[model samples]
Target chain A: MTATTDTTRDRIDDALVRLTPAQVTIAVLTIAALGFVLLFAQEPMVHDSLHTFRHAAGITCH
Target chain B: MTLTDHLVRGLKAGAVAGGAYGLFVALIGNPLIRYAETFEHSHSGGGPVVPRAVTALISTAGGVFLGILFGVVVIGALYYFLEPAIPGTDGTKSYLLGAAGFVTVSGAPWLAIPPQPPGVEQALGVETRILWYLLMATVGAFACGLSGYVYTRLRPRYGQAPAGLGAGLVFLSIPVVATIAPANPVSGSLPAELAFVIQAVTGLGQVGLWFVLASAHAWLLRRDRDEERTGYGRVDHRDPTEPLGVDP
Candidate 1:
C-alpha cells in the first residue's frame, strides 16, 4: 500500500482497537440479558410456582 | 493517553470503587450498625429505638445499591463529557488523579460526626445526609478525574504507572476519622456507654467500606494500566503530523 493509504489504514485500526473494550462490554451485557430472558421464558413452571408461593404468602407483585 | 482514554479509565475506576464500597457498606457496615445498636441498648435502660434489625439492614442495602448506581452514572457522565473539554490534555491519568484526589478530600467532612453517640441516623441530620450523598457523588467523580490527570503527568516520566492508591487511603481516612470524632459530647440525650458502643461498631463498618472502596480504586487503576499497555497499544500517540479531524 502507498504511505498515505497505509497511514489511514493504521489510524482506522487504532480506532477500532481503542473501542473494542466498550464494544465487548456491551456485547456481554446484551448476551447476559438475553440469557436471563430465555431462562425466564423457558421456566414457566418454576415461575408459576414462585408466583403462587408469593401470592399465598400475601406478597403483592410490585 | 487522550481525552477518550482518560474518560474510559475514570469510568472503570469509579464503577469498581463504587461497587466495592457499596458491597462493604451493605454486607459489613450495616451489620456493624446493628451490633452497635445492640450494644447501646444493653448499656442503656430503655428499649431499642429501632425494633427490627432487619429493617435497618434492608435500608442499608438499599442505600448502598443506590449509592453505587448513582456513583457509576455520575462518574461515567463526567468522564465521558467533561474530561475531553480541558485544554492540553494528553492522557487519562490526569482525569484519574483529579477523581482520586476529590474522593480523598470530599470524604473528610463525614469524620466530624462521632462514631458511638448520635448514631448514623441522628448524627447525620436530613440536611447533612443529603449533603453527604451529594458530596460523596461529587467527590467520587472528582477523584476519578484527578487520577486521570495525575496519571497523564506521571506516565511519561515513569513509563509504567503507579495506581497512586496509597494517597487515596490517606484521603479517605481523613474524613472517616473526622466524622467519627464528635466535636461535642452527647449529654442529657442518652447514656454515654450505649452511644459509644453504637458509634464504634458503625465507625468500624464505615472504615471497612472505605477500605473496600480504596481497594476497588486500586484495582480499576491497575485494570486501566493493563488496558492501556496491552489492550490498546501506545495510546499516547497523537499523530502530530496529520491535521486534526473535524467531522462534526
Candidate 2:
C-alpha cells in the first residue's frame, strides 16, 4: 500500500511541472512570427503595406 | 484548460477585436495618416505612395492578423504560463496582463518617443530610434514582471489590498527608467494640432485593442467554467497544488 501511494505521489509530481514542450514550442514560434512582422519584412512594398500599423503601434519605421 | 485550448480561445477573441480595430484604423487612422503624408511631401518630396484605398484594406487585414498573433502569443501563451504566479483570480489576471501589455508596448515607449506622424523630423537614424524603442520596451516589460513578482511576495505577509496597492506603485519605475533612457529628437513639420490629434488617436486605438482582448478572453474562460459546472460527472482530476486553469 505504501509503495502504491509513493507511485501516485510521483505521478502527481510529474503532472505539477508546468509548461510542456508543446507550450514552449508555440511560444518560440510566436516570437519568431512577431519579429518577422514587426522588425524584419523590410522590403519597400512590405514597409508600405505595414506603414500605418507600425506608426500606430509606435514601432520605429521610416 | 490546456494551454492549447486557451490559445484557441485567445485567437478567436483576437480575430474579432482585431477586425474591429482594423475598421477603426481604416476609418480614422488612415485618413489622419494621409493628411500627415501630405506634410512629408512638402519637406522631402513624395516617394512612391500606396493608394488610400489599398492602405485601408491592408490596415483592416493586418489588424486582424496581428490581433490573432498577439492574442495567442501574449494573451494566451504568456497568460497560461504566468497564471499560477500571478496573484489574483483568473479575471483579475487577464485584466492585469492586458494593462501590463499596454504599458510595456505603448505607454512606456511613448514617454520617450511618441509615435510620429509622417511629417515629423527624427534627428536620429532609423536604426538608432529602433534600438532606443526596443530598449524602452524591455525596461517596461521588466518593470511589469518585477511588480507582479512583488505582489506575490507581499500578498501573504501584508494581505491583498495593501500588497496590490504596493505592487502597483512599482510601475512608477517605468517613467523613471524612461527619463534615464535616450530621448528621440523629433521636430514636427505637420501642423501642431494635426500631430497631437494623430498621436491621441493612435494611443486610444491601442487601449481599445487591449481592452477588448482581455474582456473577451475572460468571458470565454467563464463560459467554459459554466459549461463544466452544468455538465454532470465532469471530474476535475487536476492536482490541488497546481494552479487554476490547468486541465487534467
Measured by TM-score, the strongest candidate is: 2
CAPRI tier of model 1: incorrect
Q: Give residue A19's lDDT in candidate 2 (0 to 100).
A: 60
What is the lDDT of every predicted structure here? 0.41, 0.74
lDDT of 2 by residue, B21-50 (tens): 777777777777877888774533456467
Which pairs clash in the backbone of model 2?
none
Give the least accurate 10-residue stretch of model 1 chain B, judged by summed lDDT: B112-121
Off by over 4 Å in 2: A1-27, B42-46, B232-248
Candidate 1: regions farther than 4 A off: A1-62, B1-28, B35-57, B66-107, B111-185, B188-194, B197-204, B231-248
Model 1, A1-62: lDDT tens digits are 11121232454454465567787588458645642332222233332322211111111111
Where is model 2 chain B poorest over a 10-residue stretch in terms of lDDT? B41-50
